[model samples]
Target: MALLTVKNLKKNYDGSPVIRGIDFSINKGTCVALLGPNGAGKTTTLRMLSGLIRSNGGSISFEGLDYQTDIRYHIGYLPQHPVFHSWMSGKEFLVYVARLANLDKKTAASRADELLARVGIADAKNKRIGKYSGGMKQRLGIAQAMIHQPKLLMLDEPVSALDPIGRREVLTLMEELKQETTLLFSTHILNDAEEVSDELLMMHNGEIVESGPMEKVREKHRVDKINVVLQEGFIPDEDLITALPSVIRTEVARGVHHIFVTDTKQARDELLQLIQAERWPLERFEVGRASLEDLFMKVVDS
Candidate 1:
């Protein structure tokens, strides 16, 4: 059964609509990603779902709960910029939020300790949040969100604000969290979504352009392309590859070449033959499915 469902969800500010009518659903124990560029209403949709804001139209249902009633108790939300009481220790902050979520004092304290350990911040639990780094803060935010064990956890651009190490830390935590509950997060980073999500919800111009299981969505809008990575200082002959009957288009960047082809099998055979004949040093050659980034661009451009 779907953990959450939405129909014709619409939101507006002033006289302009920020979210056009859209429909989507989430199932239990799945990690779903809401993907889009800036100002694409990713935050707005997440806000509405989190009950931080009211939708101007449409219905949002959580496990058969009526949309007209409060469903906030069934969800946990971490905004794009999660605010913290700088003076409060990490454990203190989580316990506070847990109490606000209606847990008793003892349960809240226990939950806070448990989550601190789960998010890999137990050692720093006594330290003031002001002293925590970006990655630590994000991990704490995630911990607080899961404190009440809400059926669905919603995060808006959760890992977008961190350095590489910080990003990796939160992503690794997210992978573990998804095993415990349903997760829905918004991000413009295709690689992050591709890495963790079971499904994807793509937005453009405030509407969901496409959404489904990650692989299914990619296949639906699949573009045939081969990615060739050459050894250092080696470059593919762009003109020669494009001249082939099976090749459609070519894109080169750094030391990699992306060749769009009509037939993957034929293209692979021909490209390998060309490379061998020319004795070019090849690092990697991959053909078939378009990457998440490539598929995302195609959806946006369409």
Candidate 2:
């Protein structure tokens, strides 16, 4: 069953619509990715879902909850750039947020300690927030968001600003956290979303371009193709490969060639036959389908 339902959602600024009557739903206990390029209204959509802002039109129904009631208690939101009390230690910060969420002092402290360890930051619990690295602070932000144990968690561009090490740290944490509660995160990074998301809600120019299970989306947009890497000093038989009946187009980079085809079986047979006939020095030859990145670009561009 859908845990959250949004219908005909609309948002505008100065009489110009940014989210143009979009609709989608999130099922229980699934990790959904809100994907789009810059200015695609990803942030605006997330804001409306988390109740951070009011939509100009449409309905947001969560778990039989009334629209007129407060729903923030059932949801957690972490903005792309989360702010913190620089002077407070990680432990102090979590407890403070937990108390604000209506936990008693003892419960707050206990929750803080539990979350600090869950997020892999127990060793830095007493360290000041100001001294925390980017990754540590992001993890702390996540712990604070979950202090009340909301049903759904929302993160906006969670790892966009972190270094490689920091990015890996948060991504690893996200992988683990998804098992505990429903997660809906917005990101432009295709690989990041692909790594952890079970479903995808793709946005572009204020509308949902695609929405479905990750595998379904990839399957619907799958392309037939083969990638070949030529050995050093061997010139690729590009002209010969393009002559095949199933070949549609070809892309070459350095010694690697990507041959786009209309029929995978036919193309694979003919290409292999040519390679064997010519005794070409092949380093690698693999048949593949469109990836999430390839599908994302296609949807956004169209």
Candidate with best TM-score: 2
Per-model RMSD to reference: 2.8, 2.1
Task: Score residue 45 of candidate 1 by CA lDDT.
Answer: 95
Cα lDDT listed for each candidate: 0.91, 0.91
Give the clashing residue pairs of candidate 1, or none.
none
Model 1 misses residue 270 by how many Å? 4.6
Across 1-302, the per-residue lDDT of candidate 1 in tens digits comes to 89888999999999799999999999999999999988999999999988789999998888867647568777889999988999999999999999998999999999999999999999999999999988888889999899999999998899999999899989998999899999999999999999999999999999999899998987877667888998888665678888888999998888778888998889999999888888889889987776888777887888
TM-score of each: 0.87, 0.91
Over 4 Å off in model 2, which ranges?
236-243, 249-251
Candidate 2's displacement at residue 138, Å, is: 0.9
* Model 2 C-alpha lDDT per residue in residues 155-273, reported as the tens digit of each score: 99999999999899889899988998999999999989899999999999999999999989887887788988878888866889899999999998886789999988889999999
* Backbone clash count for every predicted candidate, in the order shown: 0, 0
